[model samples]
Target: MHWITTTHIAVTWMLVGLIWVVQILVYPQFSRVAARDFPEYHFAHCFRIALIVVPQMFVEAATAVWLLHEGIRATPFLISAGLILVVWLSTAVFQAPTHIRLMRKFDASLIHHVTLTNWIRTLAWTARGFLVSFALS
Candidate 1:
């Protein structure tokens, strides 16, 4: 049971790290390319990310609650999970609409805005990875 909890924590952190890398390094490059030649596809890609993000936000929140209930007493992990929830909520509330508008308008400027907004998520997820790792240790 302890091993399972530890594994879950580790896996969560790994996922967070993977997501951060994708957002910070991979997605930005893709965004730049999309802005230049494939604006429509870029807009579509943003929408696709939103589709994944929305559900992921809920899942993370639920997982956090479950971890707490299961007696994970790492303050850093709990706090980080809480922060991630807040960030995800902000993304859903603030960024999602902006992305929707950008998707409709298909403007280069909007793509830049989207890319800038994604920085928050990238950093937040990276922080989450660190926090989770600390908790597991």
Candidate 2:
């Protein structure tokens, strides 16, 4: 396996684990925050998470595209790339706007929307982890 593939797998699994943590632990706790504190907390969460995830996401995307450029046209590679697109589209189309709304005020509906739509990323990244790992094998 090439080093690019190894890097891709490592990053994908890292995202997979992080997304699950967000899904299971972080997002669920949003409602638990005191209403007065929710905006500050949500702002901090958005800022801090962006600092961590945005760079990793860019790296993951670049690596995936690099793999394709390197002539890896196998089914696993294509599927993994497609899944990455799904995650991005889900984030842009659903999650990010919902987070912006939550930032202004803690709307329970938006919270639910974010949590519900985030499954798109969580599942996509999880499947990506499997696809890359299987490609490694």
Candidate 3:
């Protein structure tokens, strides 16, 4: 496999692991944060996670586009690209705004919504991880 493909695979799997942790462990625990502390904690969480997640997301997306440009028209590659799109769209359409609301105030319903909606990313990345492995094979 090409180096770009390897990098893509690595970044993709890293995101897969990260999303699962966020979904299962991190988000679920948000409601437990003390009311007075929630805003500060949410703000810090956004800043720190953005530092890690944004760059990796960019790299993963760039490599996916590069693979398509390089003539990787195989089903696995195409499906993986589609899954990447799903993750991005879900983040933009659902997750990001929800996080913004959380930053303003801790609503138990919003916490639940984020936790529930995050399955879109969690499952997409999980499927992408498997699809990329198939692409390699």
- Go through the candidates in order and give the C-alpha RMSD of each one to the true structure: 3.3, 0.8, 0.8
Estimate, for each residue in 1-137, the C-alpha lDDT of model 3 and write its tens digit. 78998999999999999999899899988989998899999999999999999999999999989988998888987998999889999999999999999999889999999999999999999999999878865
Q: Which candidate, 1 or 2, would have the higher TM-score against the true structure?
A: 2
User: Candidate 1: global Cα-lDDT?
Assistant: 0.66
TM of each candidate vs. truth: 0.70, 0.97, 0.97
Model 2, range 30-117, lDDT digits (tens) per residue? Answer: 9999888899999999999999899999999999989889988889879999999999999999999999888888888888899999
Candidate 3 — worst ten consecutive residues by lDDT sum?
128-137
State the lDDT of candidate 1 residue by residue for 1-137, as single tens digits.
Answer: 46655655655665576567656675556545633455576566766765765565556666777778888777897778677766776677766777677655556576567667767776777677678767766
What TM-score, to 2 decimals, does candidate 2 have?
Answer: 0.97
Q: Rate the local accuracy (lDDT) of all candidates.
A: 0.66, 0.92, 0.93
On lDDT, the stronger of 1 and 3 is 3
User: Per model, how many backbone clashes are there?
Assistant: 0, 0, 0
Residue 105, candidate 2: alpha-carbon lDDT: 88
